[model samples]
Target: MKSYKDLSKEELLQLQAALEAEYEDAKSKGLNLDMSRGKPAASQFDMEMDIMDVLNSSSDYKTAAGMDCRNYGLVDGIPEAKKLMADMMGVANADNVIVCGNASLSIMYDTISRSMTHGVLGSTPWCKLGKVKFLCPAPGYDRHFSVTEHFGIEMITVPMTPQGPDMDIVEKLVSEDEAVKGIWCVPKYSNPQGYSYSEETVKRFAALKPAAKDFRIFWDNAYVVHHLYEEKQDHILDILAECEKAGNPHIVYEFCSTSKVSFAGAGIAAIASSKENLDDMRKSMTMQTIGYDKINQLRHVRYFKDFDGIEAHMKKHAQIIRPKFEAVLKVLECELSGLEIAQWTEPKGGYFISFEALNGCAKKIVAKCKEAGVVLTGAGATFPYGKDPGDSNIRLAPTFPTPEELRAATDLFVLCVKLVSVEMLLAQQA
Candidate 1:
């Protein structure tokens, strides 16, 4: 397992020939596997089939507070659902939480849209401003970048560490630029890398004095409870609470959902922020709809009951997907460890693994994998505007594939990586 960079030209060419042969054989298998998105497998869904039975035709439609869920009211969400969501977000007060429809992404999109049209807490609408910008931590969630990019917001790339995004840069850009409106964060078990924000990073975030009063931290804690190992979980300070302690209560808007916990398309989502922020959002929300689906909120409350129930259910999810993560890690370690051609994250809780390949090799590797019947997320999808500056980072989503399918797909993936690395080294030699 010589490092690809150290291989002699003759050795590289020989390795290239062998890897090309392997890739050709893999192509002949006629396999089709998709690892593009972090979606739960059917087996995880099959295990929780009882949630449908939690509510039935004869079940009472009234909330514990005696409000009929079938009617149009509780524009934010039901009380029980609020408490459940608040507890999940580590917020003591349910007043800060507003549970929405099945996806947190929608809440994020609407928030950005609302700011664009109206403004944040009566500041000038973003559309009225000359320039609006957002800080995006690279190898972050693509959808988050998409939402901001769609609004014509400029995105600044921030390098990510195991602890979180580089805070010094975050602090500098936020303080110096009035146009820096917000930053996208997946604080706990972040997308792709599975990195959690450090306590110091969260405090630094809370303590920032942004030039823009409208600056907000879009904290998408999408995997707060998604842990692969019970003993090896990551936690961080509650951003809302930290902001309150730092006297910046309105500086962060946190969000979460049960999209992965229960059903992907049908689960409760929420946004937690200061009362002032909530009030401002409510003004716009009141006009958006008479109310959201209250019966569905009631259904979630009845099914999960509380944070404890959600925790227990997520443990079951860990039991299923944990092995898939380990399988991908094992292959990466066994095949690519000493090759010095790649590096990958070993996440404890999240749905993805971030792989860093040799410079200028990511796109070629992805194209090679797709040619062999294994489709991956586009090479630069992790960065803003679908551009990875080095063209070296690739996101690996192992949750959707079965254990056997994962092995085959990963096997092809490594074969492509090796073939690409060999070619890259041979070219460098010439």
Candidate 2:
């Protein structure tokens, strides 16, 4: 197979014609497949139907601490739930965790909101400052960027190398700019790319000397246990512990949830931080309400007994999602390998595949895919301000679709890539 860049003008024209015919045939099928969001497939949700039955009229409504879950009392979380979430996050003390609502994203948003209005640990409020900024590593989560953007904070894009964000730049920018208050990190099985941070990268984060005293690292560990294979799992040093060892005890805030483990909207979420940080967060939390859904928290604790229980459940999720991921990868490899027109990442775990088309071609490719009846994540969504500087990266979420659907969708995706690249090259030649 020849690389697309190696093709002569005539050869490129022939390939483009063939791909256009295939694209037309695909459009005629009138498919309505969406590979846009990293949502759990319906089949994966169906497999966990037993979770709905875990609690029933026959069940006791009391937590391990003897608090009636039916009433609101525990401001943080039920005792058993704290233990479960703590163990899942690799934290030794359950006291360090705060189990929140169904999604960790909500907790994350609230944390930023609180900080913007009231300041982190009594530092100056972000809204009061003339300039506030966050470091967003490119090809990262869109939601993370949106949270910061919503707060009217400036988002600076950082290039993400395979190991992690280019730490040399991170070190320089963060240490010198007091306005740069936080950074968003996926750490393990990162969004879109699935590139876990190396040990060195984690240490660098732990050892940073930020110019702002209130600077915090928002570590969203959403895929801590979402591996495709148990035997081939990847691990990173716990950021909480690493920060403690680095003497930056309150520098990191970690988050996780069972959105993929159980039901998406019905699972428990949590946040882990140092003692001081938790103490500080409690100030706003106490005023917000007496407590959250302790009944739901208790339900989660009872269903997924411990860390081992969570691990066992994740194995089941892996079985359902792995085939869909492979289906997309297989098509990309078969059709686009050695094609200099694009490149992509093969992740060991996570919900997405990151595809990079020729510079300035991603939006066109995505638009073309949509025209053929397959929807993709907007081209620049993986970067800050929803702007990929090079306009190249596209996140392919194969989790929600079935294997056959994934294959068909990815085939159409490759056709669009080829079509767009040929047009790009031909325009340059003309």
Highest TM-score: give the candidate number: 1
Model 2 weakest 10-residue run by lDDT: 421-430
On residues 22-130, what C-alpha lDDT tens digit does candidate 1 reach at each position?
8889999999999999999999999999999988999999998899999988999999999999998899899899988889999999999999999999999999999
Off by over 4 Å in 1: none
For every model shown, the clashing-pair count is 0, 0
Q: Write the per-residue lDDT of candidate 2 for residues 326-350, one digit (tens) a residue.
A: 8888888888888788889989898
Please, what is the whole-model Cα lDDT of each candidate in the order they appear? 0.94, 0.90
RMSD of each: 0.7, 1.0
- Candidate 2 TM-score to native: 0.98
Q: How far is candidate 2 from the true structure (C-alpha RMSD, Å)?
A: 1.0
Cα deviation in Å at residue 315, candidate 2? 0.5
Cα misplacement distance, residue 359 of candidate 2 (Å): 0.8
